[model samples]
Target: MISATTILTFIGMATATYCSRILGYLLLANRVLSPRARAVMDVAPGCVLISVIAPHFVSSRPEEIAALAITLLAASRLSMFPTVVIAMTSLGVLKSVFN
Candidate 1:
């Protein structure tokens, strides 16, 4: 069901993404990141994570908010796999009970 335009757009986007990454790697392959640059890179994931999650948290229901809090707490105490499982399970249970 994909139109030619849609297919071309997808290909264009994919090419752009790969080109950007390749360009970064090629340009920075031999360069050492400054301390500031390294620090920025280290915090980038957390900044992006907050940017992504903050909006959803703002709009979500109380049950979802509770689930998010529980997930955060679980994340602090547990590793990735257990945290993910707990978050998904809690969300599923909350959704089932509330909605």
Candidate 2:
């Protein structure tokens, strides 16, 4: 059973994430961005993704570390959809094999 505290925490996180995404659009809605600023915007999502997944790099598990390596390799050589597919498939296989 989920505790009330856990549910509230999830709600708070969702609200915060939603508000931040919306706030960015609102702030930039009328402004014309420079080429440099546009490049930053293009890479922002990838940076956020790396920040979220970076903790996995410090994990002691062999399968997780291996999976992260595989993810990095795929990300370098493939498009986003293929990279995601390869990462998820590799992680699932590695977890099953290791466990």
RMSD of each candidate relative to the true structure? 8.2, 5.7
Q: List candidate 1 segments past 4 Å from native.
A: 1-29, 75-86
Task: Looking at model 2, report the run of 10 residues with the lowest lDDT sum.
Answer: 9-18
Tens digits of lDDT, candidate 1, 8-96: 65355445544655665677789899999767654543443344346547855987788788878996897544755576567667766
Per-candidate TM equals 0.51, 0.65
List pairs with backbone clashes in candidate 2: none
lDDT, residue 31, model 2? 93
| lDDT per residue (tens digit) for residues 1-99 in model 2 | 335674565355445445555676788889999999878765654565466558889999998899899989998998655765576667678877987
TM-score of 2: 0.65
RMSD of 1: 8.2
How far in Å is the alpha carbon of 23 misplaced in model 1? 10
